[model samples]
Target: MVKGVILRQFHSLILLLFMLDTFANSTDIQPLRQLRPRLVHLYNWAQRTPDYNVIWDLCCDHGLLGLHLHQATTAYGTHVHLVDQVEPIVDKLQTQYAHRQDGNLSICLTPAEHIRLAKQAKQLFIIAGVGGETVASIIQSILPAIQALPPSPHQQIDMLISPNKHVFSLRRALQAMPFTLIEEEFVSDKGRHHEHMFLRYQPAAPTPPSEVGDALWLPATQDKRIYIDKLIKHYGALSQYSPTAFNQQALAAYQALKHKLFGE
Candidate 1:
């Protein structure tokens, strides 16, 4: 398909996410229903679907997202997948949702294992509470796994991976591979600053590979410019903390962003 067609179809799912039927106060999973707002917003962005959206809570302390999925009708229809490396977490998750017996939800013991089961559903892989490099590593590992599968005209992997740091390297990896950045935001959630990029990966067309070009960039989007300016200043200020921390790479990145955004 053409680029325009691919973009429209991908965005169609996002539009669908917002338009989905309401469950009318259906989200009642303990500890998770309290977090519905944050988790749902992230899920919408991940699936890029306004109607039926899938979400996975990869690095969860508990199955917060999954609980909401089982409790909420719209979320249930969205096909929620839970993946974790810890056996205890998965065991608790299975036990927690067992009483409800919601077949819509599935709990997986591992990321790779979950990936196999989720292939049939419109997927949104969520990996948070980890460093950015690890998140990028998981994405890199899945590149070939996704390619190995036979193309199904109707299936796609819609994902949102959030890592606390190493986002710069993650950006580099995305640029190095085939993926389209749909929406990116740097928010101060619960008073802590975070960088979250939501993207879509599909087999229909390859994303135009990008390069950092000796320096990185930060865009000027109203209030965002202030944050970017502060970020540049912060890194520049780091030179005072430790000489090693103030390296050519950091200086170069800061300088490039300053010039690009502020025309300094």
Candidate 2:
């Protein structure tokens, strides 16, 4: 009886080891899950831009977006620069990717405003996962440095930004800038609505629309309607508490958008 019991326990241990090995191998084989829709949208937009020499994933927290871009665009000879203001995060990322032999990745511990752009390089800066006001401030601080660069064949710089809240104000700020809006889209992920715009610094054009482009209203998806409804509710609540001119104006604009989109 004792011999039989020992044999059974040994077999169980072997089975457990086999299971662990299978799981470890499966992790290596399985591709990472698809990125969140907002990240995917940003990635796709950057891919469609006129060839870029460097892509800066500014405010990159975990460097996931930069890593994703690095994996996707390394063959094209594009460099991915991941910048964050925190030193620990940067250190962790540097250590995580230390084994990579490719020279296409860079992890920097610096603020978005102070990042050094390659002179004459076609650049795309992606700033997301933050509030609109902060996004505007970062861009405002960086614009002067970018404007100082000497012109080249690939001097154009593109910025793709997505703000978590106060999108209307961000839209106004972008419209006021010298950049031309290449494309803008409203994307909904996990019931949260986000607006992302691809803008290039090209002078000699009138200001774009203060709101997200008219295409937002033209989309008939339920997600679009849901997003509009959330906006309307949000502004309506703010107007009730503040009753200020700005709140009133914002509320009215959102209500009008709802009426136009849903014929309410």
Candidate 3:
């Protein structure tokens, strides 16, 4: 038992050393290169947004996206807030970045619904790598708080969203909100399809988010075509099995969208 304990301790020490070394090496590497293709796409989309004072990266697991954004936007005086519900994730991120005295980086231990931003600052929120339903819930919870904030000509709030599943539900949720679609992309990465949307909140805008997006279908790249077919199949199956009103509607919508796009 004593020998086993010593061996375990030795293994733990080796792991600690390896992790430290890896982290030290990673610091010198380009942060963007370390991200997955999906995140890299998000980073690119984020770069296109007009100057914003603060960015909130919700559900920031491992803080990679937030860290990269902080590095890229620090010169612009943009503050990056990384939020997660997990205690260990937040604690580790705080410790990892504690050496930096810059006020631009913040690690918060909280749920996405509770995120607070500067009322005066134009903010961007990126919520990715989660299901559409959860993202909808988070957005719904925060809308009231966000609506209370004073508006500015330069204070438009933007959300960069990439939902992993049930994307139609997310779009439906957005359609009920004050947000209008700014841009949307259909991305296929590592055999997974993602719909990335850039939306801005406009209280007076007449148009709401579309249940099925417009731009993503018009171009109809091969990936988009494939994705639409997949979505039709999914919704079609759901409609047949469940036959719920929404599922039937979604199936019809996608079918109509496909026919409109490819005349199929």
Candidate 4:
């Protein structure tokens, strides 16, 4: 009886604390409010710098990206745009943020059109889903728009992309462009595996082709290291033309990074 009473007391206390926190926080009116913690981490990291003004969420399903931003108290003033194709998806978006106008949310029905818009100093382009190739093309389109815009107050990344496949190809092309990585993440959300990265580039920090390489090694972070280790261990055994997540190039990228496994 005593243990049951104590457990009830603890639950009540936790509920009280949650209520207090909710009261302390102001709700940003968001239509499709779903919080993805990993993505929230991405936004919080980008917001650390004053110059990244725009946050673009492409291939956004149900506007969950906007939902996550709304939960963050510090992410206001950053123009958050959601992009996805299909009438049903946009229809759902309309149902969600119908009255929002204070720069908290904007809807883009055409992904390519928005990609071609001029990049701003505060712009932060995010393209997820699809393959690395599509992500690269969006970045390519955004570059022209970036050129048309007046010089931003500061030089930072123009895009952050998370492709479903062909990440190796994506990274290789990014190395060739004026993009610098801000953060990379490996997340398993609701049984789905995802690798997301945040990148920004300034024209001033032009990448020299001489320093460019054909392959990119995973950074020495614990998660990336573990990811590489897993891949390298599985590489040789993976059969060709297999319907699996890691492709031949991914296996190759893992092979290239095997040196990192031994602290080489």
Candidate 5:
């Protein structure tokens, strides 16, 4: 009886080890429990648009979002590049994920603006977890290099950006560029409001004010109202402090937006 019990225990231990190994090797890992909603929103958006040959996650801190994208689209030949300027973070990510069997991942220790792309590749650049001003600056810095590429019908590049603040300024900057807004969303996460947008460069097309996206006011939710109020206060302060024609115009626009959204 003793021998039989030991034998059964040994079998159970082996089974437990097998289950652990399977779990560790599984590709369908659940998202990190603490992932912010803005990142989650971006990941879902990437999954929805899976035709890109390469996905670049700029300023990718821990490479969580890029890794998630790799798992979701690797079977379809999508490669994920995680770019960050920090050396330690990049090295850590490289050590962790660079040895995967499928080999569709790259970790780049460089600024977002320095990363270049092949002219014939369909690329999606995800810029998140930063301020709007920084996001705009990165876009501006990279625009010249991207424009110099030889035009190809297959060379499609898209940017998905979620800026933490100064969204209106960012919107204006984007409008001034050759890019057109494809989609925009206002996401409230962890008591913070985030504005996310997908933009594609279309040099021949003009971007209208509608493309700048007033969608933040459409939902009529408390969060939306709060966001509007914040915008109003922000522009109000800007107009009061600077009192420039530009500031006044922006204030007028925000006031108009408030009136349209809340009838106040």
Candidate 6:
């Protein structure tokens, strides 16, 4: 009885300390209402996707998006897995979710490439808030597993990726792969342009992914226009710096895109 009482008191003390810390740093901590626009857009897009049995939020920092997904998808009996390589982050997440009885949520301390993909279950893997190179590397590591899955009428594995940089190279690398683009969007948040893409895996893909993205130029939104300008400038600088055939080609591609869009 005495040991039980002491354990209860320790738990109460830990809770009180957590509450105090939260209260002290409340200004620095962004509430759910203040989630970044890019994340909000990603979540909204994920919500539009078709039925899925599981979601893997890879490189999930702070677990905001995954937690939000869990809350929303729990009703549909979806399992949400948040994976991060950081031990501290995984520990904190485990603590936060220890009380849940639903057994549908999992927190894994592993690299995105290390997690096993569910072959039979419809799954959506969300890789966001990381550079395109990292995202590409993770995809490369997991491509073999994705390819081994049995084909189904509903795609066995779908992906939603939002990478902050090197999107062109990432797309170029994916062009020869089995991933087919289903949706694309450009979001400007905190003075950075993010490319969000939804893709499905097929053993025999019908359409090759565009290296520079086909539909990004169609809408001509202010953000898209600005991002196009940045892309042109970026490629121009790269071409000057290296003058490689590939760099020149990339530079010319963006310049041509600009002319096509603005009639320059």
TM per prediction: 0.67, 0.84, 0.84, 0.65, 0.83, 0.82
Which clashing pairs does model 6 show?
none
Return the lDDT, model 6, position 31. 43
In model 5, where do residues sit more than 4 Å from their true spots?
1-35, 208-212, 238-247
lDDT of 1 by residue, 55-136 (tens): 6667665777555554554543766667787899889877766655456676778865336634544656677767877887
As for lDDT, the candidate ahead, 4 or 5, is: 5
Alpha-carbon runs more than 4 Å astray in model 4: 1-34, 50-52, 70-76, 101-104, 114-120, 154-157, 188-193, 207-226, 229-250, 262-264
**Model 1 residue 91 CA deviation in Å:** 3.0
- Report the backbone clash tally of model 2: 0
The Cα local distance difference test for each model comes to 0.60, 0.81, 0.85, 0.61, 0.81, 0.80
lDDT string for model 2 (1-264, tens) is: 999999999999999999989976663454544688989989888888636889998888877777788878877888889888889988998876665426888888888778788998889999999998888888888888888898887587888988899887787777777887777788888889888878888766734646645765566678877787887788889889989887787778877877777888
TM-score of 4: 0.65
How do the residues 1-264 of candidate 4 rate in per-residue lDDT, one tens digit apiece?
Answer: 999999999999999999888765534522344456556655666556534466677777767655455434234466677777677898888765665545566777875555544344466666766787888777776676666667655545555555766566677677677766555666655544456766666566854222112123234455556655665555546636473654555676566665645453
Residue 154 lDDT in model 4?
57
Count clashing residue pairs per candidate: 13, 0, 0, 6, 0, 0
Model 1: runs farther than 4 Å from truth? Answer: 1-31, 36-40, 46-54, 73-76, 118-121, 203-205, 208-247, 262-264
Candidate scoring better on lDDT of 2 and 4: 2
- Name the TM-score of candidate 6: 0.82
Q: TM-score: which is higher, 2 or 4?
A: 2
lDDT of 5 at 15: 100
lDDT of 3 at 154: 59
List model 3 lDDT by residue over 1-264, tens digit each. 999999999999999999988986674542443888889999998898637799999989878888888888877988889998989989988877665427988888988767776877789999999899989998888788889898776577888999998988998988889988888887778988898998888889736668888876657777877888999999988988999999999999999988888889
Question: Per-residue error at 223 for model 4, in Å?
Answer: 6.3
